[model samples]
Target: MRPFLIALWLLIMPQVVQATTDVYPFESASEQERFRELISELRCPKCQNQNIADSDAPIAKDMRDEVYRMMQDGATDQQVTDALVSRFGEFVLYKPDFNQRTALLWATPLLAVLGGLLVVVGLVIRARQQGGAEPPLSEEERRRAEQLLRDRDGGV
Candidate 1:
């Protein structure tokens, strides 16, 4: 029983240590608030939809640590964001700067909606035109169609 308890303790020790997080000492409340806001605004690469502050992934933990360290070292919010963006690309930013690369990401939905509206408008116009215009069949064509209809019914 004693040996089993020792083995259990050994097995659990690593997880216990891993689960503990270090608290960063901020110089002021405003600095701490800024740190919190930054983490919430920064996307976690591994978690995809979750911010670094809300994610439990190892990568998020690393990111949170980096943010804390940068803030503690007196780095500005933009500086920290720039550093992470340089390392992880624009995907790590919840609100990426509008640039040529991300222009399509910001504009595609609006463009698609506009395109769909144009298509619907064109379709409505075409439908109205078709509804109003009825081409008259020639007498010979009418006779042929009637004969075909009669033959179809007779055969059935």
Candidate 2:
């Protein structure tokens, strides 16, 4: 029983240490909400695809702390975003600003869809022009076909 208690204490000690978080007291409920929103919007530079609010990376922790600090200092949402973007590049934003550089990136899917639509339309038009029925066999070709069939059927 003594050894079991010691082992249980060892197992729980690390969990207690891990459970500690950097708790920032907000000036108001709205301030706390703003903090949550900003962190959720800002991507974690280290995690690439995860928001700072949900990321476990050290960079995310740093970003969260920076956001809290900035908000406490009265930085607006855009200012906080701009600060992170300046430091980490536009990749830190989940939604980057549209610019000449990103114009092609945004336009690619539309272009592809239009191209596909055009191909389908052209195919439909071509199919309509061709029609479902083969052109009426020429009279000469029809006579030759009958002659060949009769010959193969022993002139019947």
Candidate 3:
């Protein structure tokens, strides 16, 4: 079973890896480098966690084509990124611009961590306060407990 699975994986891996290499012929090395950088920096909407350079989704392919078209038409990196952002919203960017609209998205994790710390601190203070003193027993309850202990010790 292990051998069969390994063989199956070997057969399938090439096609998966080959899918991302849709090369567009660039006029210069710098243009090709820019293209690579742009694709790697742009997020694939369909794949969500993957950049277009690493994603094999149909939308990623379309985005790569659009980028190539824009680059061929002499668009700057910022211009191409801005164009895609306008079309797909800021979600298409791997590093989204720090803006008013995205402030919550950027701040949520830190806020959650701080809130968690506050909760932990509150719990620690409560535990410390409670531990500082033993709970008081009522007078009748204390007499009953003493009587029980006396009986248990055979009145010794």
Best by lDDT: 3
Show model 1 residue runs off by greater than 4 Å.
1-22, 132-156
Cα TM-score per model = 0.72, 0.71, 0.72
User: How well is each residue in 1-156 modelled by candidate 2, as lDDT tens digits?
Assistant: 999999999999987886677688987999989899999988998885999988877889999999999987889999999999999998888878899978887899999999999999999999999896788999999999999999999999
**Candidate 1 C-alpha lDDT tens digits along 75-107:** 999999999999998999988899999999999
User: After superposition on all CA atoms, how large is the RMSD of candidate 1?
Assistant: 4.4
Pairs that clash in candidate 2: none
Error of 1 at 114 (Å): 0.6
Separately for all candidates shown, the number of backbone clashes (residues 3 or more apart, or on different chains) is 0, 0, 0
- Distance (Å) between predicted and true CA of 92, model 1? 0.2
Candidate 3 residue lDDT tens string, 1-156:
999999999999988886656869989999999999999999998885899988888898999999999999989999999999999889888778788999998999999999999999999999998997888999999999999999999998
Off by over 4 Å in 3: 1-20, 136-156
